[model samples]
Target: ARKGVAKSEQYEIRREEEEMRSQMSCHSLKKRAVLTTDSGNCTAEEASESEAENSSMDEGDDEEGSHEESEVEVLDEKGFRRTQEKKISNVKQTELKAVEDEEDDDVENLLKEEEEFEEKIDFSADTAGALKWKEDLTQKAAQVFLRQQQSTPNLRKLIYGTVVEDEDRE
Candidate 1:
C-alpha cells in the first residue's frame, strides 16, 4: 500500500512537471514569434545585413571542397530562414496594399459623392435661373396687358363703337 501511494505521488509529480514544461515552451514560442515579427519590420535593414553576411560567407565557401559541403548546409539553413522572413515580409506588404486599396476606394467614393453634390448644386442653380426668367415673363405679360387696357379705355366701347364709326362713314 505504501508502494502504491509512492507510485501515485511520483506519477502526479511527473504529470505536473510535464504540464509546466509544456506551458513554458508555449510561452517561449509566443515570445519568439513576437520577436520575429518585430524584427521582420526592418526588412530593408536586414536585407543589407544579410547581403554583407552572404558576401563574407561566399568568401569562406571558396576555400575548399570539404568546406564547400559545410557551407552548403549553412546556406540551406540560411535559405530556410530567408524564406520565412520573406513570407513575413510578403504578408506585411499585402496588408499594406490592402490598406492602400481601401484608402483609394474611399477616395474614389468621396470624389464621386462630391461630383454628385456639384451636379445637384448646378441643377438647383439652373432651376433658380429658370424661375427668375419665369417671374420676369409673368411681370412683362402683366405690363403689356395693362398697356393694352390703357389704350382701349373701355372693352365694350372698343368692340361696339368701331361699328358705329363705320356706319357714320357710310
Candidate 2:
C-alpha cells in the first residue's frame, strides 16, 4: 500500500507539471491574441469564419494537397498579424514625434503593406479553419483541466507553496 501511494503521488506530480505547461502555452496564445487583436470582441466572429473555411478545405485536401494552400494561408495570417502588431506598436510610439523624411517614407510603405495584407485576408475559409483549431485547443485544455482536478494534491501543494505559512494554516 505504501509503494502504491508513493507511485500515485509521483504520477500526480507529473500530471500537475503537464497541466501547468499546457496552461502556460494556452495563455501565451491568449496573450498574443490580446496584443494583436484590436478588440477582444472580434475573436468570436474570427473563430466562426475560421471554422467555415476549414470545412470548405476539408474536401479539397482529398485531392492534390490543395488544402495545404489554406494551411499556408492560415500560417501566413498568423505571421502577418504578429508582424503588423509589432509595426503598429512602433508606429504608435512615433506618431507624435517628429520623424526624418526617410522614416516617414518607411512608415508610409509599412502602412501600404498593412492595407494590402488586410485586403488579401479571406474570411470565408480561414474562419472555418480557425474555429476547428480553437475547438481542438479547447478540447485539449479541458483534458488538462480534468487531469488537474484528479491530481488535486499536487495542485494544493503548488498553491500552498506560494502562500505564507500563516495564511495557509488558516
Which candidate number maximizes TM-score? Answer: 1
Model 2 off-target regions past 4 Å? 38-170
Computed on alpha carbons, the lDDT of every model, listed in order, comes to: 0.44, 0.49
Give the clashing pairs for model 1: none
Predicted structure 1: lDDT = 0.44
Over the stretch 12-122, how does candidate 1's per-residue lDDT look in tens digits? 988897797566555555554554433432232223222223333334332233223322433455464453344334333333444455554554444345433443343
Q: What is the lDDT of residue 63 in candidate 2?
A: 26
Worst 10 residues of 2 by lDDT: 44-53
C-alpha RMSD in Å of predicted model 1 compared with the true structure: 43.2
Name model 1 segments beyond 4 Å from true.
44-170
**Top lDDT model:** 2
Residue-level lDDT tens digits of model 2 in 1-170:
99999999988988897798778668755654544332222332233233223333333332223234335545676676564455344343444243444565666566556544553554443555344454554556556556656666656556667565566444
